[model samples]
Target: MSLNPSPLPDSDFTASGRRVLEVETRALQALHDRIGPDFAAACRLLLGCTGRVVCTGMGKSGHIATKIAATLASTGTPAFFLHPGEASHGDLGMVTDADVVLALSNSGESDEILTIVPALKRQGNPLVAMTGRPQSSLARLADVHLDVSVPAEACPLGLAPTSSTTASLALGDALAVALLEARGFTAEDFARSHPAGSLGRRLLLHIRDVMHTGEDVPVVAADVSTAAALLEMSRKRLGMTAVVDGDGKLCGVFTDGDLRRALDDEDTDLHATPISALMGRNPKTIGAEALAVEAAHLMEEHKISALVVVDDQRRVIGALNIHDLLRARVV
Candidate 1:
């Protein structure tokens, strides 16, 4: 056989893709309509579970189960995926009495899942069954059954599990979200579960975590010369320096932009002109406790690249630039 196969006409390919999407979309609509008392019961079982939600399934359903478990876990509900096949062997030990078991099976008769249903019952774990067949064995035995039956499969031959799997995944998402809302889950709660993700960095990272402090902060006395402030900026490599009064409180800020303006005036002497003469008074500042993403927004709003981190007294405690945010991966 040749490795390269003849391709179908572009129109034919697009028609087939559209057909599949239409079938899945219809399936999702049916699933949405079917959400009622049964769905509520399933959510109640999961929410009442004191331990963790253990999702189990076989084959294509298993993949969907894994994703559902992850969604639930990241949204304030503690959950994990367990392979039904493995559970029949020994992984069943992972499911405790306090855990709620969510089993997915299109036909609701997967042998791997069926074999463990009796053990789950004996362990006193609540079982929530999601299946395309309401009268199937697994559904009948479940404490709560969620009907995910679809009108048809997306495959032309109706042999693939496309529509059924899509409906199951959507239903799982609905359950997770319902539980999340019931538990009053917040973005901060979600971020805790995803600390390594971009959302986590945006929500959890504060200015204190990324700003340059103490010696690393570029600072100069308000009475210092423009040339002296330039030296401080170069030494700190922050492209800006905070100008403070004798009491060490922030009075103004002198940046590269200021130097440019000062140089434009031939009458201004870099060495003799005090920074206070050219610095921006009441410059934009942020508290160290503020979110780092807030700093990014403040900089964008002002069309500036750096900000001075200040205290209640407007003392320059730290400084940060766009580069610092980039290095921290918060930008």
Candidate 2:
């Protein structure tokens, strides 16, 4: 029945991880220096692309190419991954004159990738290459060459793609982030792309989306007795009642805390006292268009659980408590 897990010893495994990280770190440092005019040119080409940025590679490079394409696509650049082997096998039709091809080959000599280069050129598609060798065939043929070379692989045998792959992936991120900023891709744009994510929900979920509206909103006329306001609060179960003017514009709020203070006044009668006299004036409020997180922050800052939602004309349109935000997963 025990659920606690035993700790594993870290001596040898930790050493290997440190070695791999150190190798990749050095590779990234070297890549930082190589980012010059060529990197900028690659960004410009991708930015100006009218069609998809088709990414192609072989073996390990294919995996990196897939990630790069995904990053580019998510960051506002239209792109996709195409296997070089498949390109010659009928996927070649995916390439078009309006598109740009971003080919990845650490050696610039992948037979599968090279086989499709001539056809791509014939189609008048621009080629952007990421390779370790500056004079690589792929590099020489590319309209823009991104040098993603590393001094050595994290692998002791120097045969496995390790540091090289890390450098390529990092360079891909640099291209994506640069393009995202250059295109003015905003948080709202990112939210649109990631609607199901928590960040997207936080940014896109407005107060109006989660607030209690219509009959669910707890409201009482300013002239109503404190007892009547309590009845409205109890009926709505929102912990507070919004006191409104004759025009249904919000004037103040009466909460359980306000009632506690009113109770301390021996001369006050809850049933006879006007709600306006006991209510807190200029209560914290939020517009229906505001983000839910803003309401959460306001609630935390003011030490209040509920917020009255208003329209452009400051008319009470809705109300919401912290629980509503929690239910909406905005908190």
Candidate 3:
């Protein structure tokens, strides 16, 4: 046995890549041009759905179906993917009268999918078929048939599911996005579906949710000595302390950097100097109800590591440091 290694010319590689893209682009364009009453009907079915969109397919179509299901689920439509083979076995129980079944098959003649069609019909679930063959059995039985026909496959042999699959996937996306618009799904709704994601943290996690409250907040009275403020900063371990007036309204903030700048003056009296003298007046503060990302942005803009969380009255209610955002994964 022997191996011959021959690297293709860069031009050949680039040309091949370009050809594949052009073919897929044309397939999508065909789908876009064909969108009409059927696509609108599919969107209406999804929008009117009282239950989940159960997507099923076979082979390469199955992979595309899973992604379409995910897109639908995240965009405010409750949806899930079911394997056609599994549905034939016992997973058909997952379908209900209120559910909508989205079947995908480029050939529209998948045996696995066809095996489960009667049950889905008997269950009275609305079926939306995405197939390249509008006259196929699956399309004939469908309540709404979305044509995903393509001129040719990107594969050199024209056998593999290339252009056809791309067209089907694009149609799936069109359905999901159309339903999303009709349903008025917003980014906040998307964030709710993705609670563990970064967008969720930015949208849902408020400063108060992650900031140190009550005794955990480092604070020093306006008249407190610099030495006392340093002690408060140390005990809180936040590298900063809020300087507040008698009413607890935020007057200023004192940080380790402030202390260092004060110390640079050889004649400065660290022990007897009032913290208010060394504190930064009108320090940046964020409301407790503001998003945590706002605090992170403030810190970045001011080149500081912490921010004072205040109430509507500008009274200190909490304090947050860069570490707090890190620990909460809000940053």
At residue 189, candidate 2 shows an lDDT of 90
The prediction achieving the highest TM-score against the true structure is 1
The 10-residue segment with the lowest total lDDT in model 1: 1-10
Q: Give the TM-score of candidate 2.
A: 0.92
lDDT of 2 at 136: 92
Q: Per-residue CA lDDT of candidate 1, range 105-147, in tens?
A: 9999999999999999998999999999999999999999999
Error of 2 at 146 (Å): 0.7
lDDT of 3 by residue, 271-302 (tens): 99999999999799999888888888889998
Enumerate residue pairs that collide in model 1: none
TM-score of each: 0.96, 0.92, 0.91
After TM-score superposition, the amount by which residue 259's alpha carbon in candidate 1 deviates from its true location, in angstroms, is 1.3
* Reference-based lDDT, each prediction: 0.94, 0.93, 0.91
Where in model 3 is the C-alpha error above 4 Å? Answer: 1-4
- Per-residue CA lDDT of model 2 for 62-146, tens digit only, reads 9999999999998899999999998899999987888999999999989998899999999999899999998999999899999
lDDT of 1 at 222: 87
315, model 2: CA deviation in Å?
1.4
* Candidate 3 or 2, higher TM-score: 2
lDDT of 2 at 149: 91
Q: Give the residue spans of candidate 1 off by over 4 A.
A: 1-4
